[model samples]
Target: MTRISQTTRLEKVEHIVGSGSGLLDFAVKGENGYDTWEGNEDADWTVEDVDSVQNVEEDRYIMYPEGDYFICEIEADTEERNSGPVRCWCE
Candidate 1:
């Protein structure tokens, strides 16, 4: 007699960067149910996350299929370089 069943799926992410429009975005929910946007980083702000896009990182970036929480930020609009959209919170 043999019986085996193993299934695992966990995805909860939260990341933010938008104050001065540096660029870095993430917002994933558990069991796949939430999402956010702003990904793509660093247009040359002394290398804040400007590694030519694609998982850019300096302060925070590249968050997918992970686990963690407790991140809050506010300043959704500063006006400069694609100005706007910068608000975050993770729980």
Candidate 2:
């Protein structure tokens, strides 16, 4: 079995609004037939992989199970309330 970990920084977060509130949906790719986990307390989030096989390509993923996560910022709604670019590096 190969252990591969991936992380992705959300793009277009500025265009993604907070709906007059301070929240947004964040997404990450996972592998199918594998168990995955997520948390907000880590500097870099981690997920567990338990797959017999794996395959991945650019700009797409196949997570056996699909889910959604959230991020709540303290910024208010304004023209200048846009956030800076997010950077992600995975190995």
Candidate 3:
């Protein structure tokens, strides 16, 4: 007989944009190390994962490790609000 073991690790994360009123679109680097942008129909936003995203604090949001890393791109109506490539380590 053979035995195998596996572990699932999760961490907290936050999405920070220059200027935005609501949750911005986001994606994460899966364990396989790939960015899956299959978030929304437009592929610009992700469905809210209540379990992962905990709370919203001003310009920052609290999320968990649904993936290895977090990534987001935003196109705001104002130049000051426009931001992109906002990423962070979820591990």
Candidate 4:
């Protein structure tokens, strides 16, 4: 017979909004999944990875690892809105 054991790690991070048009940026290279919130829901928002920044859209984004790690950046049309703490974890 064989036995296996596994463990999970959780990491939480909060990012404050500065002088920008409600833009939030962060890198998620070693996390399993993450969620972002605290922004204008009506305003035009776009979410993109480090590879794509010029794209635009209107939606909320929650990121998950799909075999590769990536840095996500979100931009909103409104400003002065702070991004709440983001929670991420790995299992």
lDDT on C-alpha atoms for all candidate structures: 0.31, 0.24, 0.31, 0.30
Residue 83 lDDT in candidate 2: 37
- What is the Cα-based TM-score of model 4? 0.24
2 or 4, greater by lDDT: 4
Can you write out model 4's per-residue Cα lDDT over 9-90, one digit (the tens) per residue?
A: 2232221121124333333334333332334333343322322223234532334332244323333222335332222222
Deviating ranges (above 4 Å) for candidate 2: 1-43, 52-57, 65-91
lDDT of 3 by residue, 1-91 (tens): 1111111122232332211343342332333322211112232333233336544556655455455444333233332222222233423
lDDT of 3 at 76: 34
Predicted candidate 1: what Cα RMSD to the true structure?
14.2
lDDT score of residue 63 within candidate 1: 35
How many angstroms is residue 53 displaced in model 1 relative to the true structure, after the best TM-score fit? 14
TM-score of each: 0.27, 0.17, 0.27, 0.24
Candidate 2 C-alpha lDDT tens digits along 23-72: 22233334223211222222223222212212334322332211232221
- CA lDDT, candidate 3, residue 6: 19
Model 3 segments more than 4 A misplaced = 1-44, 47-51, 56-61, 79-91
Model 1 residue-pair collision total: 0
What is the C-alpha lDDT profile of model 1 across 58-77, one tens digit per residue? 45444322225424232322
lDDT of 4 at 83: 38
Q: Output the better candidate (2/3) by TM-score.
A: 3
